[model samples]
Target: MEVYLIRHTQVAVDKSICYGQSDVPLAETFARDALALEQKLKQQINDLHSAKILSSPALRCKQLAEYLGQEIEYHPDLLELNFGQWEMQAWKDLPPEEVNPWMEDFVHLRPPGGENFVELQARTARVFDALPQLEQSPVVIIAHAGVIRSMICKAIGLPLSNAFQIEIDYGSVSKLVCRWGLWNVKFLNL
Candidate 1:
């Protein structure tokens, strides 16, 4: 299976805000960014519209996926880590006591009402593990940086704690190939 994981375009929210799993608007550059991404996919795949399109229900991701093809499958497992009560709060404004613990070990510690990285990884794995059943030549997943990183970690056997090191930029595309139940990362943040 050829999996292309594409992060959504820039969001309208401020950089300081914590917006995991929150519905956010796309930035002003959405159209331009989406167009460029479409062209990029077209180069790799013969029919952009025919490739199986899966995306998180988030508006940011949905917009990009719709731009690529009208037939899209939305899955909750593709969503970013749920930030719980910190949905729209500024990162600086979060209570230090609560943030400190999670900052130290976010893989296991939950942010008040949010889930940990392990949960995110498990959900993401479910979607990826099922890819073989679809028997599709190419699969396009439009999701967040966190989701992409989780998939990368699983693909490369990297630890969840090191996920941040992958650097998944907005509107970036990462490719992975799966064969005989083994996964290999082809490229990242393209």
Candidate 2:
């Protein structure tokens, strides 16, 4: 099975604000980026109709998915890291030590009111399990940076703490092919 992953375009929220799972508006200049990304995907996928497109339920992701000119299957499981109470707060505004706990032990450290990568990975596992049933179908999953990172770690058997190692930028594409119970990472953070 072939899976194509891409992150959503930039949101209007300032960089100081944490926006995981937050429904923030996209940047006003998204048309250019969206068009470029769509063209890039078209180049990658000779027959765009051959790939099934899916996206996170977040507004940013939903809007970007529409640029593909197909009905995207919006899945709640595709949402970004649920930052809980830290959704819109700046790092400096958060408690001193708690802010970086996730960097140390991401799997167990839960954000004030949100979940850690552990929870994110668990949900991703469910999505991964279901993908096998759709073997031979190339699927395009437009999600968040964090979700894509988690999926990469899960695919490569990297420790959860290493999720930060993968760099998935907005509108970037990555490809994965799973065959015979083995995962082949064709592209990452493209």
Local accuracy of candidate 2 as per-residue lDDT tens digits, 83-145 = 898888997798868887666776789888899888998987778768778744788988998
Error at 158, model 1, angstroms? 0.6
The lDDT, on a scale of 0 to 1, for candidate 2 is 0.84
RMSD to the hidden true structure, all candidates: 0.9, 1.4
Cα-based RMSD of candidate 1: 0.9
Question: Any runs in candidate 2 off by more than 4 Å, and if so which?
Answer: none
The residue-level lDDT of candidate 2 at 91 comes to: 71
What TM-score does model 1 achieve against the real structure?
0.97
Residue-level lDDT tens digits of model 1 in 28-115: 9999999888888888888877789999999999989888887899999999999999999999999999999998999999988889
Backbone clash total for model 2 is 0
Name the top lDDT candidate: 1
Per-model TM-score versus the true fold: 0.97, 0.94
- Screening candidate 1 with a backbone cut-off below 3 angstroms (N, C-alpha, C), the clashing residue pairs are none
